[model samples]
Target: MQAKFLKSLMYEAQYKDYSPDFVMYDTLLEKNIPVVEFGSGTGRITLHLLEQGYRVFGIETDEDYQGFFLNKIKEKGFIDNFCYVTDITEVVEICNIIYPFNVLFHLNYQEVEVELNKLYKFRHCWSKLIIETDNIQYINSQSFRSKFNQNQDYFFKEFPRQSKSKIIIYNEVIEKNSLNIVLKFEYSLYLHKADDLNRIYNQIFPSAKLYGDFNLQFYRKNSPKLIAVCIK
Candidate 1:
């Protein structure tokens, strides 16, 4: 990505009410775990990880973006501590087959399964994991899902309408298999208010408690962005 495109990404973040420093570094301060970031676009979070003394590996599919990351790594003289590769499918083969480092993944909602499937074997190897992706709530909403194509001029986006409709249409399978909570966890960001979430959860898992507030560091408050973390 060119610096201009990167800046455009940042500007979008700014428009959402998120500050640069908050999303860039401070959020990871409490944990000094080594990081392997998937879909590491333009080194946004990778640079902050390096500055905090944590070893960082970035996985990117686009060759141009991978080169951008490499150039930044060279300029910063972090050749040893920070590295990036192009293909994530072969990540486990290249690194340890088991737990290598705490994983940090940032991708679209459609790729959540892909990322999870890739790291399923490696999950036990790490001490912690963080997944940064779209809010399930937003994707499920008619307005938000439509906004993707509308905002981008509907060029070539693959909206995961099946995933959204699956949970609703197959509620019997969901309740019988205890998949309701998982669905809520994934889509909690779509709730406009805390009460809205509370009501939805009560309707689904009545006894479930709201664990915490949304961490808006990686997103602007009003924007449709959401970052969910699952630590095992």
Candidate 2:
């Protein structure tokens, strides 16, 4: 069941902008760094890191995706170079290693951030952390409920009228003042409105360097699928 959900998501994500592999590989090639990916789905970024001979570790919440990655490592006999964990909050236990090649993308940012915060409770561990996901605004009064009703009433009629209230829950948890902004760009088409996204970006990542133009990816050149890289 987990595998099915991930597979479906991957199939959908392929059409979006920003190949995470391309971004990570470019950074690694330039910096000569190793990697550790959290919320890696089916070793999508993990496999690329492994193929490049980068020591990689992955944390996956989905058991089926975790199993799939484990099987791949086993099949390739990469006992020393690659590691994966199923639990969301498992701390990485790499000794004497300075930096790891990092590529992470999870659907649930609130859950993943809590787990990652637990795993790396002490800061200054990873030299780099790359994340990709839907943009959720925080500490802002945009009335996402109005947006949801305006955009999704035809499909989500069965749900509560204030369905977008959940968006606030996610934003409050994920967009706290812990991470510094690095880079942010759009990726998906169906996730957010472009105007809302730009406004949120200014609020959360006011200092982040824009990686590419708003339409650099497949976002109809005007969508709200943002791809951002931030620092701690």
Instruction: Give model 2's TM-score versus the native structure.
Output: 0.48
TM-score, prediction 1 = 0.47
Give the Cα RMSD of candidate 2: 13.1
| Candidate 1 lDDT by residue in tens digits, 96-161 | 211111122222333434445555545455544443323333433563352121112111122223
Runs in model 1 lying further than 4 Å from the true structure? 1-32, 85-111, 134-226
Weakest 10 consecutive residues of candidate 1 by summed lDDT: 167-176
Candidate models: Cα lDDT each: 0.41, 0.41
Q: Local error of candidate 1 at 126, Å?
A: 1.2
Q: What is the lDDT of candidate 1?
A: 0.41
Regions of model 2 farther than 4 Å from truth: 1-24, 28-32, 85-123, 134-207, 213-225
Q: C-alpha displacement of 200 in model 1, angstroms? A: 17
